[model samples]
Target: MKFKALWITETAEGKFERSIIERSIDDLPAGEVLIRVKYSSLNYKDALSATGNKGITKKFPHTPGIDAAGVVELSRSEHFGTGDEVIVTGYDLGMNTSGGYGQFIRVPASWVVKKPEAFTLKECMTIGTAGFTAATALHKMELLGQNPEQGPIVVTGSTGGVGSLAVAILSTAGYEVIAVSGKQNAWEYLQHLGASRMENREWVNDQSGKALLKPQWSGAIDTVGGNTLVTLLKGCKLEGAVACTGLVGSPKLEGTVYPFILNGVSLIGVGSAEMPMSTKLKIWDKLSGQWNCREKMNAIAKEVSLEELKNTYIDTILKGNVMGRIVVNVEA
Candidate 1:
């Protein structure tokens, strides 16, 4: 059956064009399950794919949504059956394969997870891939023995999806959170999301030539790379860890190994793109339970239709002006 979708194509001149178009499940790439998507979400990676970034999407006329939550319309795998609520994130769903911008999606069973009972289809999109990444980062930190007693945890890119969720989960779990963001107006919003305090983006920038600075945060969840990651490493407490993700600032890092050798600060690279289903399910369980941030997730997310998604969020997020997550209702 034909369904509504947001289609992106490349012009002969090699530019990208986007619009709402009609699609069909039969046209989607072959997989083990067919999902009638209820909700999708706009993410930085989606914006990149929509804008014709080959790194995120190589082919033209693609559907770009990294996060999808819906019900299984058809399932060939014994692990999943028809009429089940499910979610698909990362694992090439929206990268090289057809993704969630369409009303229906067909993906590998390995790319699917049973929607946590605590979250509805909409709330799952609310947490989406961004929240999942944050949870993975925190989980790694906790596994490494990083705790509140060491010192406060700093969340860079604090107003964006991953950073915001990091603040919420960390604070909810009794950790002191220092939200560092450039959006001054979001200070109050960050506080409501459980940030114990707030700092301007300046905290992530350091120009001093010192090999290491005074230890401040016990650990850090860094969403911006480049100098920000370097700064976080330089100021991390002894034996503390930094969960590094996102390169909105830049991909380059030019810092000495002083923090690693002397302070024992370990750099933990967190990437959801290629995570295993076993680890993904474990994190989703926590997100549906104690690590879940319903209030913050709902408050921080803006709901938009597939049409509104293209008309708005793509540019806002690409320019780094996004305040929080953008939820897209594919059914709308």
Candidate 2:
């Protein structure tokens, strides 16, 4: 049967266009499972792909959604059966392969996870890759022995999808969250997400030549790397850990190791794309259960139809004007 999908096609002159196209199951890449996608969420990477960013995607005429939640329509693996609720994120969902922007997706069984009982398929996509990444960063910090008693935990880029969710999750987990963002309008929103305090981007960007600063924060989840990360390193409490995820600011890390050797600060790298399946499952369960912030999650997400995704990508994420997650209802 043919299904509707938002397909990206490239002209011979290299221009890209997005339109609703009809596709069949046979059009999908070979995989052990086929999913009828219920919902998908937009991410920075998806915007990159939609705009022909070679770093995130090498091919045109491709769907560009990195995260999806839906039900199994077909399965070749014994691990999952037809009609089972499931989620698939990362692992080439939107890069070179067809992604969740479509009404259907075929992926390797290993790339699929059973939707946690605490969440519906729509709710799972509401959390999506961004929320999952935030949770993963917090989980790593907790594993490194980070606690609320040490000092306030800072969240940079605090109004974006991952940053906002990180603030909510950390606050819910009993940590005092200090949100840092340049979007002045987001202060109230961040406060609603449970941030104890807010810092303008300028405040966090202030640089001192000193290798280490006052060691103010006990721990942090940094989504904007580069100079912001450097500043964060200088201010981290002794023996504190900071999980670095995105490069929205800059990818280069330029600073002294005094924070590491002298203050014993730890820099943890969080990558959700290639994480082990077992680890993904654990994090998903936590997000669905204890760490789940339905109110905050709902507050940070906007629902849109697949047809609206193109304009949303160009006008919002690509321009960095987005405030929270954009959840796409493929069938809407």
Candidate 3:
């Protein structure tokens, strides 16, 4: 079948260029199942991969989408059959391998999860990798004894994809959520996601050189790494937990172990990509069931087409200009 896909090509001069081109089933790598991608989502990693970032994607002439949801077009594994709904995210997808920007994807059976009955394909993509990462962090923190009554849970980068979903899901679970963002213009939007309060970006960039500052938050979900992550660690209450995921700020962590030794603060690292399937399933079940924020997520999501992605969001998202989740209708 003829289908459309975004291809990022590294020119002979080592510059990168993008194109939406036609692909066939033969072009997809061999796997046990074939999915007709109904929806995919734009993510920071996708943006990085599109720009010829060797760390995120060592190869070019590649399709970049870390998240995809659709129906099974074919299956060799007993785990899935044609027309079965499925979700594909993470696990080397859109990295060295062909990804979901194309209308169809063939992947290993273990890499594909049966989409929960309650979650539609579009809704799955709406939440995408960002939502999955947020859910994973919270799941780990809950296991570490995090609770709403401890104190307000602060979410840094609260207007970005993972940050926004973290705010909504944490709020839905009854935590008093304090959203921190540099986009002062989007305070109303953060509140709409159920953040009880707002804090400017400056709130998480403390540099007083104190080994441990006064504990303010009981817990935090940190998407912006670097000094902000360091600040959150310093301010967390005794037994407080902070889930660290993105490195939009910086990957290098330069802080004392004082928070852990003195305050009993737990820093949890979250990695959704290449996340074990067992853990991934648990997070997905919650995202599709009780913590299901499809209605709330739909409100924050802006749909875009494959054709619109390269021209519009590829550059903007890299510059941190996105508002909330950007869901891509690959079928469009």
lDDT of 1 by residue, 68-183 (tens): 99999999999899999999988898877888899999998988899889989998988888998999999888889988888899999999989888998898778999999989
lDDT of 2 by residue, 206-315 (tens): 56577778878998899889888998988998889999989888899999889899889999999999999888988987887778798888877889998788756545
TM-score list, all predictions: 0.98, 0.97, 0.98
Give the per-residue lDDT digits (tens) of candidate 3, residues 1-332: 88899999999999999999998889889999999998999899999999999998997789988888999999999989998999998987888888889898888999999988887888888788999988999999999999888999999889989999999899888899999988969888998999989999898899799888888999999988999999999999999999999899999799999999999999999988887788888888888777887778899999999889989998888888888899999977
Question: Which pairs clash in the backbone of model 3?
Answer: none
Backbone clashes per model, in order? 0, 0, 0
- In model 2, the runs with Cα more than 4 Å from the true position are none
